[model samples]
Target chain A: MQINLPSLDGTENITAVCMRPDRYTRLYEALTCDTPVIARGGGLSYCNAGAGRGCRTVVSTCFDRILAFDAEKRLLTVEPGMRLGDLFEFAVRHGLYFPVLPGHPSITVGGCAGFNVHGKTQHNVGHFIDYVERFTLFHPDHGEITCSRTDHESLFRLTIGGFGLTGYITNITLRLIPLKGRSVLFQKRFVANLKEAVEVMKQLSEKVDVLYSWNNLNKTGDAFGEGIVFSEQFIDEETSARDKPFHLFTPDMRSVLRFNFYYRPSAHMECAVYYNMERLTGVEKRCALKATAFPIHGKEIYYLLFGKQGLREYQMLIPHDEWAGALDDLRALMNRMKMPLTLGSMKFFTGAQDLLNYRGDGICLVLDVPANRNSVEYFNKLDEIVIAHKGVVNLSKDSRLTAGTVATMFPEYERFKNELNEFDPKKRFNSALRMRIDV
Target chain B: MSDKKTAVVIGASSGVGRAMARELAYRGYRLVLVARDRAELDILAGDLRIRAKVEAVVSPLDLAAATTSGIQEFVARCAADHPAIERVAITAGQVSDDDQGPTPLPLLESIVKTNYLAVIELVAGFARHMEQHAGGTIAVCSSIAAATPRGRNTVYSSAKAGLETYCRGLQHHYRDTPVRIQAFALGYVDTAMSFGQKLLFPAASAEDTARYMADKMSTDFRVGFYPRFWRPIVMVLAHLPWGVYKRMKF
Candidate 1:
């Protein structure tokens, strides 16, 4: 079977079954038939985060359903294949909120749990794991086990950021937060460069619910790292009974975008115009919750824009102590190499995780460098800088991770590997990233 | 042309399978269209129901993540809906086995994975379902390139050849049985795979291939040549001496 989801290219006859999200018969089939089974949910990952190298029997949870929703508990239990966007809509319908909304709408709950994905407001709150109450893991050998913060705490913690290698995370119980009338106040400010932006972001993080900066990686000289730092906080304080706004684009606009990206991304020009437009105003605006949360709603265009060669997102968490010097060196390298940083985002993380963890109490810089050129060479160079600063790369979004880089970047790599071996000795759960990282 | 007589097109989202789906629906058979994209499948199913006026069951399958029994369960569900599965056509194969440049091992293995393992499992699953019903056709879309192995497409050529052999072996297994297997040895097909490549001969459209395969599905003959004329051409090439075949570039 030929399956192409976003940037990840998977060529498999996909030997496994497409059952309703209810049953765990896939594990039995994998065991009985003597084959390896990989759980696939939503298939929204940019890299082969949900996929393995070569081909393996795929147990897809595409038959997604909302199993149970306890309004009193403010908890929702959904099939892992449920998309984050769908979950957001579901939450808002019930006058609630589910905050670990990844920028991409197509991302699933299973993928969020697997990667322990974070939002723009990570510094203010925490990663996706914080909202998760419990989840059911269909272990290849152990069968289905319900794990959470209390019962089997180690498994629960490990599985949160475990990259789907632990087992098939069939169902997830997410503790829903309260929605403040589906309205948000957005503040956008212009920062000349990273050095000044750092202090500004630190100050903004304390004031706003969400704070992040989009740096202009293309600019050099005095304008290097020049970007607009945006902040968002719910503005339901004044207004009452705010209805959620979901903007659906017309078909013609989508078609044009789909076609334009094939030739070259018209989006870069649009971003430039947006930056200039925001600079002109330099004021706060009242916006919809959807507008604030999913800024890049039409990310399918971004993936198509990358073309066949694909894109690599080198997201590194630079600690507070080392960000100043390391980022300066990285900026110099980017200027000298003339590296094509298509998109660069910097945000603050105020949490940490143990195994294959990307979280840390520091600033994380995500550089979306196009893989069209010999950019892997540039990424490798950046990895060295990350290693010096003891900054770990984001496991969920990375493309070309090596054993050496994983070992250097993640100090807990050895312990994670040891623990993983103990639980999944047969190594039933595997992916391309797992192979690359040798874990 | 009973609605009970269903046809399962494995790659119904696009290419040959999609065209085959339309052809089958026109032929008055309910369809089980399988693919990874559920949204595409849903839209296609809705369109098929309205335009084709046939029951099109959307089977959203990510084959890479599926197991053998998982496929059985998939077939079972389809059987539960449109009981009599009279035809199972698998036209879902990728030609990413081009080794002109340095290719990774995992990527190289995917050639066998997609072209062989995936299709064979589908055949085994659906073939069993059809056999119990005691009347059905198994049509597999293969390539003319498989007639003779080449270094340029080593994994694809070998896997395709292996697929043909598997079908032949199945033929021997079901010789006494009424189950029919049609191995379509196709010549140049003007698909995305054939695009930008210099064609030595006029390539067949996906529609032509699908129509021919769907019409001649129940034929007594096991192997079919799409466009019909390529039978003699591929026959000549299959018997060529290895020494001479090695020097010739496809």
Candidate 2:
């Protein structure tokens, strides 16, 4: 049936034919159909990557299930629809941990694999693809094919960050690392500005188990990037700390109402208040492991506050050496633009860059601005600065990036398109992102 | 080694059946997931075992082709294998949109067997076994379409209506016994069955519907409508005059 499919940031909504299949037989039927299809997990992508204008969007939420968990091997076999929060909770019980997890627990593992998501601890373990051992993808023409580093090596690389265009990912086997304990010493360090925040993050990246910084972009001059740099290190031993159960939060109408409460006062005020409150609060506190990994669960209302007009989320990875120059450009653009930056954050990432994968040695900067008439111009300017610095824009997070911008940012864009075309000439699996990028 | 009671959830692969299995598993009941799709059943069973720390047994069976005696034997085997089997829920149902139009005889028989005959057979088997064993609860899903047979869903609604009447009779017969029977006349549930259909009221999610059914399974409730709002609406519709109803389009 045709349903209104919205992006995570509410930037775009497309009325597409959506099918939610809970069983394997139904999923097979959905994949084998003649119509162009795309697999949707959690529908939490900031862009309209999960749905296309005319293609059928196959929602995999109901297909969520863990097929196998071998604690001895520290390997987990799960369906594409399983949420990261549910995976984390299950892993913690067995004294294992999934290192590369996105902030929102509701984000699906399939999404992470598709986007090649980088997390707070990405500097240490790399992208989500680093942990995915293998996956079984079902294409309409190709049927089911197992892709991994050893077998179908090229297909594996292309499909990892192919944005679900390769096929419908049915089964994924993830390799997990061992955890010391379920508790962490969560610390909040105050930074004076973007320069200071970068210095602190670089210094602590080698020491902290998990590291990320939240900047108050609403501020100007010296206070522009001034915010809290949050760090977490696992406790040596298991304490009697009572951790909250793992919950995959699904937003309801109440969340919208709650978001409007904080939203009407303006996001700038909220940012300043949050920054000042964190500065006043104690630096160190014991926190549950899941809390450190998924801080966005309870605060899902924040995403809703953007309202129907939505917000443009531009996440770019800038090299460590070029970050200083990029920061200057960002400040200059911020001063010149009328659009307020609703959110700004940064995380360290280290990985070998490949076909369309959002991975490299850099400080990933994420910015959210309320969508408006000037959104296109503001982001276009931001895009020029990023491309000049040889930075890569995260296609998964930003919806407004032009096809020209993406081609300019990622050198392997053409190769990805070629490989995808060679694999499936018809491109049976498709989405809005694919159509937008003209890939 | 574990002393947990087992719950059999028929048609546990999809829709409300799938949700019902998850709910029962969460409630600390060892599950017997019965469905025709073995792959789907295995996936669900594995998930329940991991998430809920409960044992789940996958029992693959084609309810449309299942015989009454065959179903009785299966129930007896389940009771014998797990003496702790204290609850049974039948959430299996089938419907074809072609039912409103001219449907083939084979399709009609399949629907009857799946929606009515198979459900009644399983209910009878479970109720009798539970009566002899420890007094267990048996709940089956009916439909709000059964309130009054309309031209929209002729055979499907008729089958559900028959199943509902049979369950009511079973409840009356088991009133003095240890067996407790609950029949849920569900409304438009957000399952594959109602995925694309435009309807007046928003379809209730299968998860929420299953949770309600699971909550009432152990209680003394005999018969009720899911999403309770459907109860009054169906009641009014059932009481409507034949002339007025015939002219209405829903």
lDDT tens digits by residue: candidate 2, B1-250: 3557989999999889988998898899999999898978887888899878899999888999888777888878877777777889998988887887556789889999999988898888888888887788999898898986777668888899999899889989988998998889998898888876777787887878888988887789988998899999998999999989998788
Alpha carbon lDDT of residue B52, candidate 1?
Answer: 50
Q: After superposition, how far is residue B70 of candidate 2 from its true place, in Å?
A: 3.4
Question: Candidates' TM-scores?
Answer: 0.60, 0.90
Clashing pairs in 2: none
Model 1 C-alpha lDDT per residue in residues A325-385, reported as the tens digit of each score: 8978887887677655677778998776467878887888987755644667888888989
Against the native chain B, each candidate's TM-score is 0.91, 0.96
**Candidate 2 global lDDT:** 0.84
Candidate 2 local lDDT, residue B115: 93
Off by over 4 Å in 2: A236-265, A276-282, B1-4, B26-28, B46-55, B101-109, B146-151, B154-158, B197-212, B225-250
Clashes of each: 14, 0
Task: Give the per-residue Cα lDDT of candidate 1 at A243.
Answer: 56
